[model samples]
Every structure is written in structure tokens, then in C-alpha cells.
Target: MVFWVFGYGSLVWNPGFEYDEKVIGFIKDYRRVFDLACIDHRGTPEDPARTCTLEHIEGAVCWGAAYCVRGRPEKERAAMQYLERRECEYDQKTLVDFFKETDPLRPALSGVIVFTSTPDKVSNKYYLGPAPLEEMAWQIATAVGPCGNNRDYLFSLEKAMFDIGHEDDLVIELANEVRKVLGTMAKEKKLVGSPLKPLKSQTQPQIPTVQLHLLPPEAVAMDL
Candidate 1:
């Protein structure tokens, strides 16, 4: 049987696993939200970064990529092992119907899996749940970790979505708010207008170029 995994956030840009094929797909009845706090992986415990996760919402659809691993059980096992290690915070796994956007009228692909945690999935200490956009922005703007600035994660994911011609309004709005807060933080810390740039503040915050090997242009262009 072919095994498939769904990616909606950082996984879209950095899957960190090999697969036989990848296709742009959408999962119904759910939406992506940056409500989870990245305490261990993306940020330090003292200053955690906000990250994305799926929330079930009727009539909502989440656009993402589906990875297919087939032909060998060992290959599938190894891929799952890597994913589990990478997504340790996301403890819940659910099988969902993933429909490729290339053919919306057709049935969903076989063997689709999504790793997510709901509010009722027992209160996760890292789960931030819902909060004001400005609050989230401030947290994201100020947090940095071994991986990098927390805002970079948000910026990169937004760019990835835009590269596929899928404009996520929520992410755009949050990024704008985060930049505003970042500017304030820079000024308050006397890090702005200096020869040496602040560690957290970007001079222009341009979108970094990314080559999406997993999501080909044609595969996701239909989503636009």
C-alpha cells in the first residue's frame, strides 16, 4: 500500500524526509493556525516561538502537500520514524482524505496521514491555543532559537505559500503585525538606525528564495 503524509507549515518547506512523489493537495474540514508554541524545537523554553497546526473547522480547507512513499515497507517505516522524531510535539496522528488540487473532482489520494493535536487532545503545555494577533506577533518577533529567528519561520512559510500562488491572508496579516512589533522592539532596544544591525530585526525583511523540490510549480499552480 502507498503511504502518504500531509504537510501544511514548515514541513512544506522542510519535510526532512524522502518520498517517491509529492503533490499539492487539500484536506477538508480543517484550517491551519499558528496556535502552537515551539518551545523545544524552534525556540528556547524561556522564549518560545509560535508555530502552525491544524484545527478542525467545518467547511474549512487546508492547502498543503502530500508525500507518497510506496513499494517498500521499510522505506515507509523509516520515513515515519523520521517524521515522529521531528514532530514530537504533535502527538496525535489521524488518517484523512487528501484531495489533489490538480483534479478536484476526482477522489482523494490513498493513505493520507496528518499529525495534529486538538484542544481537547488534553491540554498541551506548549499549546497556546488562540490569542490576539498583536500578542502573537510580539511573541514571534522577540523569540529566537537554535534554528533561527521565530519570525523567519513565519516569513518563510508565507513565502512558500505565495510561491505556489496561494495567498494566506491570516499569515500575511500576522507577518505585518510581527514586523510592526519588531520595529518597535528594535527602536526600544536602541538597535535601530545603527551601523551594526540588531540580531532580531531585519533591515528590509525580504522574502528569502526557496527551491521547493517536493512541490513542483505545476502541482501547486492549480491551487491558485
Candidate 2:
């Protein structure tokens, strides 16, 4: 059986896995949002970096790449293991229908796995939920980790989307905002407001309980 995985964030640019085929496509009813926190890859425990996570929205379409691995079970297993470790921050392994760019109305592949965080921050510890664009941009601009700076992740995704002929508006806006923040910092000859320090006055945003729709039996049956 062929195994399929969907990439919307860093995976779009760096899948870091072996695959038989890659198809550029979009998944329906889901939009990418920079609402997830990363403490290991792109940030420290004290100052987390904002990363991309899928937010379910009506009539939304998230464009990305879909990779399929077949012909050998070991190859597919290795890819899944690597992704599980890389996407450890995500709490859910969502199965989403993938529609090719050439035909958006019909699903080109069913049961494609997508790593996503639960909406409630309590349930998903890494989930940061929504924040103002400026705040997010500030975090992205200043935050750095072992992998690299958070801004690079955002910028790389923006460029990757453009290369694939589908530039995400939200990504572009956030990348531009981060650039502005960086520019301001450079002009000031210092970092902006000591972003590394915890903000005592900042309160956590109220997270609503979002009941995610369950996948069909067939989809669940295809789980790795």
C-alpha cells in the first residue's frame, strides 16, 4: 500500500524524507496559521518561536505538497518515524483529502496524513493559538533555535509556495511584517523590547474549545 503525507509549513520546503512522487495541491476547508509554538527546533524553552499549524475554516483552501512513498514498507516506515519525531509538537495526526491544483473540485488522493495541533492550548501544550500579527512577527524576528532563526522558516515557506506557483497571502503578509520588525531593530541598534524576556503584563489568549470533525472509517483504516 502507498503511504501519503501532506506538507504545509517547513515540509513544503524541506520534507527531509524519501518519496516516490510529489504532487502540489491544496486541501479544502483548512487554512494555515502561525499559531503553534516551537521550543526545540526554532526556539528556546524561555522564548518559543511561532510556527505554522492548520486551522479549520469554512470555504478555506490550504495549498501545499503531497508526497507518496511506495514499493517498500521499510521506506514508508522510516519516513513516518522521521516525521513523528520532527512534528513532535503536533498533537494530532489528521487525515485530509488532497486536491491537485489542476483540479480543485475533486480529491486527487484520500487519506493523506497531516500533522496538526489540537485547538485548545491546554490539550496541545505547544499550541499558542491566535495572536496579533505584530506580536507574532516580533516573535518570529527575534526567536532562534538549533535549526535556525524563526524568520527563515517563515521566509522559506513563503518562497517555497511562490516557487510552486501558489503564494499564500497570509505567509507573505507575516514574512513582510517580520522584515519590518527586523528593519526597525537594525535601525535602533538593538533588539526590540527584549523579546527574550517573558512579558509579565501579557495574558494568554482565551482558547475556545474546537471540536474537530472525525475522519471516516476508511480514512482511519489507512492510518500508519
Candidate 3:
């Protein structure tokens, strides 16, 4: 069976999976979203520290590349394990979605993996819009994982955008802005304040109040 993995977010570059081909695939009703989400992989189950959001953009579709792995049963299994590792935050559940490539001439390719987590699991949801330039910039500048740095992501997207000759002022501008901000962060020793704290403040807060006085005779008549 051919394994199809969706590359909506950062997975485009660092999927940690082995694949032979990464082709641009189109998914209907689902566009890339930058809405932030706090996920378990990065933090405690009660409070996921940080993660990106992917909301459904109606009528609009996203164009992302997918990778097909050339491997035997064992190697493929290993690759799948790698994917699961990433899904730890998404509740270890993923959907196999099919898509049509943008290359009107090329045949449809089964490439791309979509991860769906429980409603509570996703801290925040976002629709297709300018990416979280700040978040991405921080990640790149910090170089937290195998992906190395957030600047790399920005550069890759910038290069890809130029290669496609598709000019998205919003994306491009965000990319540049992220680069600038990251540069500032680099100049400083570390980022001040917590980035994920903002997400946790969303939980509904309850307020208690005491009645000052009872209703008058008019209210008693209405009750009667």
C-alpha cells in the first residue's frame, strides 16, 4: 500500500519520515492554518506548551508536497513509527486523506498526512492566513530540533515561494518580518517572557456574585 502523508505545516521540511517523493497535493475544504495550538508533545497533558494550529478554510484548498517512501516492510514500519512520534501531540491519531495535484497535467498523487486531535487537545485553531511568523522565527532562531532553526523554515518557504513565482505579499512579508525579529532575538541572549502563556489564559474564568436585595411586591405578584 502507498503511504500518503500530508505536509500542511512544518512537516513540509522535517517530517522525520523517509520518502522518495514529495509532490504538491491539493486538499479541498482544508487550507493551511496558523492558529496556535498547545500540544502535549511540547508540554504536559494538562497544558501543552506550544504548537501550531490548522483550521479549515472554506472553499479554499492548500497546496502542499507529499513524500512517498521507497522501502521494504521493515523500513516502512520504521518510517511510520517516526510519523507516530510526531503524532504524539495529535492524540496518536491521523487520517488518510487523498488529494489532487495542482499540476493539471500530472496524475493525482496520494501524498500527505493529516492529524486530528481532540477538541480539548488543540489549544487554539486558526484558518489559512499568514503563518505565525513570530513563532516560526523563534523556533528557527532557536534551532530547537533536528530541523535546526526557524530561519531555515522561513528561507525554505521564501525560496519555494520564489520558485513557484507565486507572490503572496502576506506570507512574504511575514517571512521577512520573522527574520528581522529573530535577528533581534539573536542579538539578545534569550527571549523574555513565556510565549505559550498566552494560550493558557483562554480557559473560561468564573466569577462569583452575591445578590444585594430581594425583589419588591411587583416581582412577588408576577411570581404568583
Candidate 4:
């Protein structure tokens, strides 16, 4: 049997393991949500960063990449071990169907193992449940942990989704909000080189003001 793993969030950009083949695919009946709290990779326990999770949403679909692990039994075991260590926070796994982007009408593979955290509010400590995009953005904007800045994670995922010709509206909108908050923080700290340029004051050209570019309606109207 070919071992396959589905990556929807960070795995989309960084699988952190070796795979024989990677295919762009989508999982049905679930949607990507930034409702999980990151106490390790993107934030400390004291201040957690909001991360992505596959939440069960009827008639919904989540676009991501599925990696196929091909090797001898020992090699495949090592690959699974590595992924489990990387995805330690995720406490649940479900066999789901994966549909390839090239032929989305049919299932490319069935019984593929997809890892995800429990959606229950009482059971999982890292599960933050659903919150407003702005609130989630704020958490992701300011939090930094061992891996790197939380904002970088969001930015990278946004770019990755775009690269795959899939515009996740939630990710796109939340990332923009996070950029706004980050821009304000940068102004306060006098940090430069942010992708969103600081506003230039006409009277005081030397002083940089914070002004974030809102995503145009056209951009938001792309395939969701």
C-alpha cells in the first residue's frame, strides 16, 4: 500500500519530510481555519499564535498538497515517525479522500491519513475554536516562537495558496489584517522594509505614517 499524507496548513509550504511525489489536491467536507493555538512553533505557551486547522464544514473543501511516501518498510516507518514528531500538537487523524487539482471530479486517492487537532473546545488545549478574523490576526501578528515570527507563517501560507492558483479567502483576508497590525507595530518600533510601505506625510516627509492597503474587491473575488 502506498502511504500518503495530506497537508493543509504549514505542511502546504513545509512538509518537513521526504516524499516520493507531491500533488496539489483538495479534501472535501472540511475547511481551513485559523482556530488552533500554537504554543510551540509560532508562539510560547504564555502567548499562542493562531494557526490553521481543518474544521468540519458541510459542503466545504480545503485545498492543499498531498505527499506520497514510497520506500521500504523501514524507510516508510522513519518518514511517519518524522511527521508525527513535527505534528506533535495534532492529536487526531482521519482517513479522508483526496482529489487532485488536475482531475478534481474524481478522487485521486481514498483512505489517505490526514492529521488534525481535535475540534472540541473542552478536550484539546490547543484548540481555540473560532474567533473573529481581526482578533485572530492580532494574535498571529504579535506572537513569535521557536520556529519564527507568526506573521511569517501566515505570509508564507498566503503565498503558497496563491502559487497553487487557490485563493483561500480566510487566509487572504486574515493575512491582510495581520499586516495592518504589523505595520502599526513597525511604526512604533521604527522598523522598515515591510512589504506594506509606510505612509508618507506631505508636511513632514521624514516621518513615516502607517497606512495599510486593503485588498481590492477584484482580488477578493478570485476563486475561493
Give per-candidate clash totals: 0, 0, 10, 0
User: Over the stretch 18-105, how does candidate 2's per-residue lDDT look in tens digits?
Assistant: 8889999999999999999999999989999999999999999999999998977888888899999999999899999999877878
- Residue 176, candidate 4: C-alpha displacement in angstroms: 0.3
Q: Model 4, residue 199: what's the lDDT?
A: 59
User: Tell me, what's the RMSD of every candidate?
Assistant: 25.0, 28.6, 20.2, 20.9
Superposed model 4: Cα runs more than 4 Å off: 190-224
lDDT of 2 at 73: 80
Report the error of model 2 at residue 68, Å.
0.4
CA shift of 131, model 4, Å: 1.3
lDDT of 1 by residue, 1-224 (tens): 67889999988878988898888878889998988878876788998899999899998888888888887888888999999988877868988888867776564775588999756425677677889999999889888888898999999999988876676888999999998998887787785556774676565687989986787788899888
TM-score on alpha carbons, each prediction:
0.80, 0.83, 0.54, 0.82
96-134 per-residue lDDT for model 4 (tens digits): 999977787899998888989998878898899998877
lDDT over C-alpha atoms for residue 191 of model 4: 52
User: In model 3, how large is the Cα lDDT of residue 111?
Assistant: 31
TM-score sort, best first: 2, 4, 1, 3
Can you rank all candidates by lDDT, best first?
2, 4, 1, 3
- In candidate 1, position 44 carries an lDDT of 86
* Candidate 1 TM-score, C-alpha based: 0.80
Q: What is the lDDT for 98 in model 4?
A: 95
Which is superior by TM-score, 1 or 3? Answer: 1
